[model samples]
Target: MADILLTAVINKFVEIGGNLLFQGGGDLYWFKDDIDWLQREMRHIRAYIDDAKDKATGGDLRVKNLLKDIQELAGDAEDLLDEFLPKFQQSNKCKGAICREFAMQIEKIKKRVDDIDHVRKTYNIIDTSNNNNDCIPLDRRRLFLYAGETEVIGLDDDFNMLQDKLLDQDLPYGVVSIVGMPGLGKTTLAKKLYRHVRDQFECSGLVYVSQQPREREILLDIAKQVGVTEEERKDNLEDNLKSLLKKKRYVILLDDIWDVEIWDYLKLYLPECDSKIGSRIILTSRNSNIGRYVGGGTSLHVLQPLDSKNSFELFTDKIFHFDNNDWANASPNLVNIGRDIVGRCGGIPLAIVVTAGMLRARERTEHAWKRVLERMGHKIHDGCAKVLALSYNDLPIASRPCFLYFGLYPEDHEIRAFDLKNMWIAEKLIVVNSGNRREAEDLAEDVLYDLISRNLIQVAKRTYNGRISSCRIHDLLHSL
Candidate 1:
C-alpha cells in the first residue's frame, strides 16, 4: 500500500506540473492555483505517510485507520484526475462542465486533507521525530560510511586467535581468512585485526574484492596504501606490487573475495616467501572454499554469533546508548524483556545492533521495550525485517524514494552501478550538478555506498578497479 500509494501520489504531481495545462496559458488560468494548492497539501500528507509506515504496520490501530483514510482520499484524487485532466487539457477554455467538476473535487480533496490533519494532530499520530539519520543525504554526499564502525563487542577470542596468526613470526607468508554468514562480524573482525597489527608490518593495504573486482585498481590501491617508492612506481602493477610486498613484509586485507579468480590475479604479485617478516593477508567471505583456496585452510577464526551472555551484553550497550543510566536503574522490568529481544537476535551482531536501533527510538520503559520484543516474534530474520523497516523509517526524507526504487528490480538481481545512477537521474531522484552527468554519477555512487554501510543492501559485485560494479539486497530486505 505504501509503495503503490506513494508512486501514484508523487507521480501524479509530476505529471500535473509537466502536462499541457501546467504550461504558461494554464498558469494564468485553469488548474494552476488549485492544482498547486492540492500538490502542496498532498506533499505534507505524503511526508506523514512516509513517516507513518512503521506505525501503520506495527500494530498501531490508530495509524492503520488513518492510513486507510489517506489511501481512500488518494484514490479519489487519482480517479477524479483521471477523468478531469484529459478533458481539461483537450479544451482551451474553462467555461465547461469538466472545469466545475475538477474544481469541486479538488476542494473536496482539500477539505478531507484538512480534516485528516486535524484528527492526526488531535490523536498525536503525526510523526514528531526531528532526528535524521545520516545514511544518505542527497544534497551532501558522503563517500565512506564504513569507517570507524569497527567498535565491536564480544570478539575478544576471535581477535586474539587472528592476532596470534598475523603476529606469528614463525608462520610463513600466507592468507588468514574469516568465514561466516552475512551480517556476522567477518568484516568487522578483519578490520579489528588489521588495526591491531598494521603497525607491526613494514607496510599495509586493504581493499574489498567484491565478486568482480578490477585487478588494476586492487593492485593500485594496495600499492598506494603500502607506500610504493619512486623505483617501484616506475614499473607496472605486477612488478611494482611484487617488488614492494615480497621485499617489505606487508599486511594486506582482501574483504569479501568471492572467486579464487581474484586470488589467481593477486597471486601473480604476492609470492610465497620465508616466515621471517611474518607478512599476512586477511580475507572475509561466506564461502569457506575461498579460504581453503587462498591459504590451504589455515585460518583459525570463522566468526560465530556472540554467545547468550554476550548477546545480552551487546544489546544492553546499544539500548543504553539511547537511554540514560537512571532509566536503566528504574526499568528493572526490562531485563527479561531485553533478554527476550536478544534471543530474537539469534546471536548475529548486525541483528543485535539493528534491534537495539529499534529500541533506541522509543522511551526506555516496559511498554516500549515489550512492544519491540513482541514485534520480534520467534525468528531472527523476522527481527531483521523489522531492522529494514526501522532503517527505512530512519532514512533521510529524500533518500526514501531512492531506497524504495530498489524494490522495482527483480529479487536477487545484480544492479549495475552506472545503470542505477542513470535511472535515478532520469527519475529526478538525483539532482545533476548543472546538468553535469559526471557529478550526478558520483552522487549516485555515494548513495549506494551509504545504503550498503547501513546493511540495508549488499554488494553483489565490484568493478576490477575497486568500485561498486553491481549491488543487491538480501531476500529479507527485498521481501520488504
Candidate 2:
C-alpha cells in the first residue's frame, strides 16, 4: 500500500505544481523547484516498492509492517499538501516570511522521504522486474458483477426466503437485516432481494451507510432519490423526506450499516405507510447486534459460507468463465490443484473470486498451479482481511488510499457523498483538471465510481438523478 501511496503523492505533487503554474504568478515560482524535488524523492521511494506489493501479500509480518510505516508517511505528505493548496490558491503572491516558511516545510518533507529511503535500503528489499502478472488490472476495467442468470448454488433458497420476508405484504413496515462475516455474500443477497421487490413499492432505493455516516447528507440523498426536487430539498431534509414518503409504499435497502445510531437517524425519515400499503427497510450488517437493534420483530438472516462442493463450483466457474463444461478440458492434476486452492479460501465468495482471478493468468500446469498453492498457504488461512488484501493490492496505487480511507469509518457506517468528496479533495487525492472545488468534487465522484466499478465499494443510496448518494466499504475491506 505504501508503494501505492508514494505513487499517489508523486502524482499529486505534479498536479499541485501544474495548478500553481496556471496562476502564472512570480511568487509561486518558489514552489516549482520544491515540487520537482518531491517528485524526484518519490521516484527514489518507488524503487524499493517494485516488489513490495508482492512481498507484503506474502504474509511476511516484517514486510507488511514496513509498508504500513511508508503508508503513514505518505499520508502525512498528502495532508501537508492539502493544507498547502488552499493557502497557495488564496495568495499566489507569497509574503517574504511565508515564502521562507513554505520552503522550510518542503525541506522537511524531503528529509522525511530520504529517511524512508534509507530504511528501505537497510531492509535489503530487492526490486523485482516482473510486471507480467496479468491476472487483473488494478482498476475499474476488471470490475466483476454477478449476472442475474448466474447460479449462486446454495443462495437460491436464502434468496427466496429473503424475498418472502421483503414481499410479505402482511406487515405495514419492518426492518430485516442479513448478518454475516465479511465476504459471506450479505450484500449480494440483499442486492438480489432489492432487485426482486424494488418495483413492488411506490418508491425504492438502496442506501449504503458506512462506518462514518453523515446523517443529514444521507437523509438528503434519500429524499432526493425518493423524488424530492432540488428546489424542495433545502432545510429540514429529514422532515421533507418523511412527508414525501408518508403516504407511499416504499422499500429502502440500507447496506453495510455499522452502528444503530445511523439507523436511529434514518428511520425517522422513512415513514411507516398505512396498513394497506406495506413499506419495508432492508439492511445488511456484519454485526448481529445491529440486526437485533433494528429487527423490529422478525428474526435476522445469518448467511453461512458455501459448502465445499459449492466453493469448488464457484472457483471453477470464475476461473473457467462460468463454462462448467470447460473443466473437463483441464488436466486432472490441475483439477486436483484447483480444489486444494478452493479449500484454502474457507468458502468466502470474495476469496474465491480473488483467488480464482489470481490463478486465471497463471500457466495451467500442475507445477505452476502448485506454486500458487504454495503462495496461497502463506496467508489463505489467516482471515478474510488477508484474502481481501489481494484485491487491495490489485488496486492501482492512486486508488488505494481512496479505498482504504473507507476503513476509517466504523463497521456498518454509510458515508455521505458530499463529505466523502470533500475529504478526498482536502487530502488532495482527487485530481481535477478544472482546478475549482465544484469540479474537483465531480472528479472525486468519478474516483468513487471507479471504486464502485471495481466492487471495492458499494452504493448505499442515490440521488434523484441517479448519482450515488451514499457508499459502503465491505467489512473485510474495512478491516484491511
Q: Which candidate achieves the best TM-score against the true structure?
A: 2
Cα shift from native, residue 260, model 1 (Å): 1.2
TM-score of each prediction = 0.50, 0.52
Q: Which parts of model 2 are misplaced by more than 4 Å?
A: 1-151, 171-173, 273-276, 322-325, 379-480
lDDT of 1: 0.70
Candidate 1: tens digits of C-alpha lDDT, residues 311-359: 8888878877744673448556777788887876667787888778877
Error of 1 at 56 (Å): 18
Poorest 10 consecutive residues by lDDT, candidate 2 = 137-146
Please list the residue runs of candidate 1 whose C-alpha ends up more than 4 Å from where it truly belongs after superposition. Answer: 1-146, 229-235, 273-276, 322-327, 377-480
Pairs in steric clash, model 1: 213-464, 214-463, 214-464, 214-465
Please give, for residues 1-480, the per-residue lDDT of candidate 2 as tens digits.
565467668768767666745456477876787787877777666665746656766777777777777778787887777776677677667677766777788788777777766767776776533244435333321122223433465588899888887776663347677877667787777877887788888888766665456688678767777888786787666667788788788888787776679888777767653356678888887666677778743648878778899898888788888455667788888888889888767667878877787777776789988988888745443445553454455555566668767867887699998899888777666766556778877778877876765456777999999989898875445544
- TM-score: model 2 vs. ground truth: 0.52
